[model samples]
Target: MAAGAPRIFVSHLSGVAVFDPAGDQVGRVRDLVVMLRMGQRPPRLLGLVVELATRRRIFLPMTRVTAIQSGQVITTGVLNVRRFEQRPTERLVFGELLDRRVTLTETGEEVTVLDLSVHQLPARREWEIDRVFVRKGRKGSAFRRAKGEALTVEWTAVTGFSLEEQGQGAESLLATFEQLRPADLANVLHHLSPKRRAEVAAALDDDRLADVLEELPEDDQIEILGKLKQERAADVLEAMDPDDAADLLGELPTDEQERLLSLMQPGDAADMRRLMSYEDRTAGGLMTTEPIVLRPDATVADALARVRNPDLSPALAAQVYVCRPPDETPTGKYLGTVHFQRLLREPPPTLVSSIVDSDLQPLDPDADLPAIAGFFATYDMVAAPVVDEAGSLLGAVTVDDVLDHMLPEDWRETEFHLDEEEVATDGS
Candidate 1:
C-alpha cells in the first residue's frame, strides 16, 4: 500500500451507512451529492448522501474519509442532513485525503491516526484502502502511552472491526500465552517485561499455570505463586502431577506451605505430602503414580482407549504394559507391551499376546536417578514403565523428570536452547 494513491470513487451506494463512534447505525447513503465548479470543469463530490425526514439529504466530503473496508467507509466529521444541505460550496480532491488526522473513538477510548497505505489487488487490478495505523491516546492528554506506563486493558480492549481497519499495535501477546508449551513458556518468560509477565500470568487459569510451573525455575515458581491468591495457588499445586506439586510446595515458606496444603483438595494434598516425604532428588520423589496398566486378559482395544484418555500426558510411550489381576502372585506372567504406533496397522481383534513386543526393557523402582536418565539418552525413550522387585507394575518415569536428574542444579538458570538441526536429526 502506498501513500498519495488516487482516491477510489465508490459507485454503488445502496448499502453504505453512516456509523457512529460506538458503531451504532445512524444513516444510510442515498445518493452522490456533487459540488459544481464555476467553469465547464467536471463537478466534484461535495459529499455522499444520507436521506433524513422532511425530504432532506445530508452530504459528507470525500476528503474526510479515513478508510474503507468491504462495503463501508469511515469518515472524519459527524453529519446532520439539514446542516449538510444548507452548507456553502467547497471544492475537495484526492490531494486533501492523504496524511489527514482522524480521532478514532472506540469503547470511549480515543485513538489517533499515524499513517495509512493503499493496496492494489492483482486479479481484479483494482485498488482498495488497505490499512490505517493508530495509537491509543493517553488519558486527559493528546499523547499516547509509552514504555514504563501502567496501562490497564480488559479482554475486549480492541474491537475486531477497528483492528481490521488499522493493522498496528493490535498484536495480542496475552492471547498467545495458552499456545506456549511448558518449556517454551520457561524460555520466553525472562525476556518479557514485568508488566507483560504479570499480564501473561494473570491470563492463565489455575490448570494452565500448573502446566507452566513444571518448566519454570523453582525461584520463578515461588515468585509467580506468591502473586496469586491462596486459593489460585493451591488449585495450581493440586492440579500439577504429585511429584511436581511436592517439589514446588517444598520451596514455599512454612506459613504459605501450610495454608496451601489446607486449601488443596484433601486427597490431592495427601498425595503431595506422600511424595514430599521422600528426598527431593530420589527415585520415589521423581516418579509419577499414573501409569497405563491393563489386565492380562484385556484386549489391545482396551489399552488403546486408556492411552487416549484426556488426562493422559502428551509424552509418547514406548510400550503398553499388560499386567495380571491383583489377586495373582506378582509374576511377569502377562504378555509384554505393544508399540503404541503399531496398533494403527494391526487389526483391532488381534489378541494382546500376539501384538506384545517381548523384547521391551523395564525400569526398576529403586534404580539410581542419574542411571534412569542415562537409559533414556541410550534408548531414546520419552518414558519407561517402572516395576517392583517382584515384577509388579508400579509407576512411570518421564523424560522431563529424567532431565531434572541429569542436568546440573544451575543448568536452567541461564537461557535454554538446542541446535535445531541436531534436534531434527535426533527426532528423526
Candidate 2:
C-alpha cells in the first residue's frame, strides 16, 4: 500500500495532528483529496481548521507529507495559515463540512463522532476544508513540491475504519448520492445518455435532483425530462414551480407532451395544462403557482400565522395578496398585497387594507415575458401578480423565477478560464 521514491508512506494516521519538520503544531488531517480521474497516484493531503483560536486549517500537498508515524503526523514545512473567513471562494469547503462528522485520530483508532459540536466548524457544508494543495502560484499544475513536511501515514494503516463508523454529519458520497457542484452536475447530466440520465435521476433523492434541475438550461431540462420515466418525470416536475414546469413542458413535441402529461398526478396535470393554455411568452405562462394569498378581513395576526405555514415559498415574501371570500372566488379577487416586513417592523392588529399596497403594479395575462421582466426592473419588485381582464388573480411571478431564463448556463464555468490553454496544458 506504499508508493515509490520521493513519496513516503506511513500507517494508521487519518486525522493525525500534523506537525512541521521543526515539530510545530500545524493542523489536523482533513481528507485525502485525490483526482480519481488521475488513476493510482498518491492522494493529496488536505488539513482541516478554521483559524488559530478559531481552529485554523490548511492544505498540504501529497509532496508535503514527509512521514506517517504510528500515532503522529509529520510534515516537511510549516503551512501558511489562512482564515476561512477571508476566503469566500473557499466557503464552498466549509459548507460541505458543515454537519459532517469525521473520525478523529484517537489512540491510533477511528470512532464514529456523533457531532462536530466544535465552534470553529460552521453549520453548513461550505465550511468543510476539503482542499487540494498545489505548489504556491501553480494552481492546477499536475506536479508540484509538497509543503514543509513531505510524507504522512494513511489513517487506515494504524487502525481499521468500521462501516458502522459514521462521520459526525457528513454523509458518505457512495452511501447516499454524489454531492457535486451545480455546474459539475450539469456537465455530467448533459453528457449522459437517455437511459443513464434517468438512472442517475432516479438514484438521487428528490431534494438533490430538485436543486440540480433548478440550475440547468431549458434545453437540458427537455433532454433530462425525455430520458426520465413518466412517474419519475412527473415527480420532478411536480417539485418545480408551475412557471418552470410550464416552460420545460412547452419545449417538448406535442406527442411527448401529451404522454408526459398523462403520467402526471391529476392535480399537477391540471395545473400544467392551465399554465400551458396561455401563450408561451405571456405573464400567465410565467406566473408561478407559488403565491401568498390571504383573506382581506384576516387580521395581521392571522396573516402572520399564514406566513408561518411551512409550505409558503420565499420564506420572506414582500407582499401578501388579499383575496375575496372563499365562496365567491376561491382563487381570490385581486385586492392588494401587504408588505410583510413593514408589518413586522411595526406590529399592528390593523385591517390588512390599512397596510396593503392598493396601487399594485399588475400584469395582464397575455403580457410577454420580456415586458414582465421589464415590470420587475421598473418597479424594483421581487414579484408581480398576474390577472385576467376581469381582475381575477391568477398567480404571481418572482424575479428569481424569471431571471432563470435570462442567465446563461456556462456563465460560472468561465471564471476558471479552463479552455484550450489549461486542458491542453493539463493533458501534457
| Winner by TM-score | 2
Compare the candidates by lDDT and give the number of the best one. Answer: 1
User: Candidate 1: lDDT over CA atoms?
Assistant: 0.56
- Backbone clashes for every candidate come to 2, 45
- Superposed by TM-score, candidate 2 places the C-alpha of residue 41 at a distance from the truth, in angstroms, of 27
Locate the minimum summed-lDDT window of 10 residues in model 2.
Answer: 112-121
lDDT for model 2 comes to 0.54
TM-score per candidate, chains pooled: 0.51, 0.53
Whole-model lDDT values for every prediction: 0.56, 0.54
Residue 337, model 2: lDDT of 81
Compared to the true structure, candidate 2 yields what TM-score?
A: 0.53
Residues 362-403, model 1: lDDT tens digits = 776567787787777887778776666667655567888877
lDDT of 1 at 123: 28
TM-score of 1: 0.51
